[model samples]
Target: MEPEAKWNGSSDQVEFSRMSPRSQGFTKLPGQKTCGKSVLLFTFVLLISAALWGTLLFLFITRYQEIVQDLGKLRESCVYHNDSGILTVIGQLQETQLNLKTNVPQLSKTLNKLQEDQTTLKSKASQFSQQLNRFEEDGTAFRSQVLNEKNTATQAREKLQEEIQKLWIEFQRANGSICTKCPENWQVFQKKCYFFGKEPKTWAQAKYACINLQGRLVSIKSREEQVFLNRNANKKGSWIGLRDLDIEGIFLWMDGSSLNYTNWGRGEPNNQGQGEDCVAMRGTSGLWNDANCRGQQDSWICEKLATC
Candidate 1:
């Protein structure tokens, strides 16, 4: 300061010193030894750093609010989609339930119908079984009846064969020499010709019947002849040639021969009040009886010479 003052306080220097601090701020300061350049530089840098940090904090706060808003929107969207998904699942469940409801009754009805059909089949099978059993029993009975009938027929055939054999033998013995054959429905015995009447007739009618056929009433002359006549006659009595019409208590034959053979029953030939005068032989016993000439008798026997 002394050095500059020695230069005789020049007018310009004095004026510069009297200028304001604001105008000469970098130039000088009161009681400041020298200018603090490095301190100023450090202060400027700190201010710049504070301003940059304030800008970055403002940007971060603003972006954080925007991000929170975006998150809220996303949460709403997720909730809506979840609700829709749940509704869809519920709808599907309801559809499935409806389908089951519709089909269950139909299936149940089908099952019941099948069961009924099975029961009906069982009943039909039972009925068929019973019918089969009845048929079997009927078949057994029919077979037994047939067997019995067959046995009876066999026995009857054997008896018929025996009778035929006897008849053939008798035929041979009776007609060996004459070689004669009897008429249809007629039986042969010994060598005599006989006609046995099945219908009833009066004694006189019987006599006439025999005469019409070139024969006469049978004259039983011997015991063998009586037996022969009895064997051929039917169940009832038959007219003979013997009669007492010419005289009471005296019998004569139709051929004008006297009655030589007699086989009267135990209580016969009484010649009751009606005046029985005709003669008939009992078919069963071959005994004699005196009956009325006009009375009806079961049969009559006619005799003729064998057809020689």
Candidate 2:
């Protein structure tokens, strides 16, 4: 039979009596079972979602801690590397400074020495320039003096020549001949007189002797005069009016005339012993020889214009 269902107001429940088997099966409804299954499934899904979120949160915290630690280590390493690099740079800079300190003084001293040497060179150059200037000035003055002396010598020689010509004319007019007679012991040739001395005297002595006799040492001009003097020389070495008293190796006559003719022997005027400065005629060949002026003694010849 089917159970009758009644509502009990005091219990607020539904009562089943004399229930059939079909009604007993009706206690568990299909909609209530489906609703319970749906609630259990939703609870299980919520638990699984919570567990997954906790796990993900733990992993994230752990990774964050590891990253913080790695950052700290990197900071420390960078600080240490920077400190080491700074120390190395500081050491190098210090070494460079020390080298500069060591070398600066020496470099300064070298520069100073160079400056001093340059100054000394400039001073020496200035002194040399001054000396050269003085030498040039002195040379100009010497040239002027020499020119004046040469002009004076030329004028004196011309005046003396005019006086000699006048005297010669007067003598010729007085004697009624082309030439006056010469003094005794004097040989006459071509309007001139010559005297040969026998005494052996120094060149200075012979020169003075001729001057005392109002004549001069013989100056042989032409070939004829030379031959005449040679013939009368008596084959004896005699002093002539040729000498290099002023300058060596430059013979000039006593009257300041340059040599127009020379009759020098072989290797003559060698200035033997650096002392021979006078000229003499050789007795054998009539060729000239250089002799010592003050040290040698030789016979001499004198010459003068013929007089009335």
Candidate 3:
């Protein structure tokens, strides 16, 4: 048993209590009554608390690591989605650029076509203007030609009128009415045409000239025919269609008909020692006379049927 230490007068002396503080199976110490069983129980309780704290800390650290891994996976998913969006935008831009390249050349070609069409229109307008000028020149030339033709026709009409006036004056001085519209330089009788010669010819030549006019030499069928022919002789002896070539002193007409008419002059048909075989009419007395067939210095007269 152990005595309890008194505090007041116990500097050197200790007081003892009636109850001892020591328990069973304890190592008693100075004045404390600590038992071995109590000490061992306290130590066991401290060990269990330390073990629980360490287990709680380990569980928190494991949960934090799991959260960090989930965050990393989310970041990777967002990056992939953003990259796909950017690629889609870039592809759209490239398509737009290609469309611009294709359309721009077509627009340029259309503009060029418009310019060409404008130039062609201008060229055609110039050609049309040139053609119009040519047409005007041709019209002027045609009008000039028509005016010249009109002037020529007027001059011809005036000359024809003067000729008609001269012919009317001559007809007033004749013995009978004149025929109209005879050929130029030919005298018109009742139904015959007479051509007067300016030059002299032989009796045979005179007969041939009448033949060339579609007739024979003049033959007197009546006194009126003889008088009509003598007026045209103009004071010159003219040949008649009378000859004695077949028989001397038995005269035959040049037309081979019977000698049905005669108008012998005063010293007629003596043959004149020159073989006078052709007959002629004297213009002064208008009487028939035999002449040499080859005699020159005699005017010729041609007779033909009148065409009108």
What's model 2's lDDT at 258? 83
* Candidate maximizing lDDT: 2
Q: What local lDDT does model 1 show for residue 191? A: 53
Cα lDDT of model 3 by residue, 158-231, tens digit: 44654565556456536465434456777777655677665677887887777676655766777777777788
Instruction: Tell me how candidate 2 scores on lDDT.
Output: 0.86
Query: How do the residues 242-295 of candidate 2 rate in per-residue lDDT, one tens digit apiece?
Result: 998778878888766789988988999899985898999988778999998886
User: Candidate 3 vs. truth: CA RMSD?
Assistant: 36.8
Q: What is the TM-score of candidate 1? A: 0.41
TM-score of 2: 0.47
Descending-lDDT candidate ranking: 2, 1, 3
Question: Using Cα atoms with residue i matched to residue i, what is each candidate's TM-score against the true structure?
Answer: 0.41, 0.47, 0.39
Q: Where is the poorest 10-residue window by lDDT in model 3?
A: 16-25
Q: 2 or 3, which is superior by TM-score?
A: 2
**Mind giving the per-residue lDDT tens digits that candidate 1 earns over 1-308?**
22223234675554332555555667856546434766788899999999999999999999999999999999999999999999999999999999999999998999999999999999999999999999999999999899879856864664465456457657766776453455545455565578998789999899889878766787777888878778878768999888887579888776555767889998878998789999888878878989988899999988754543
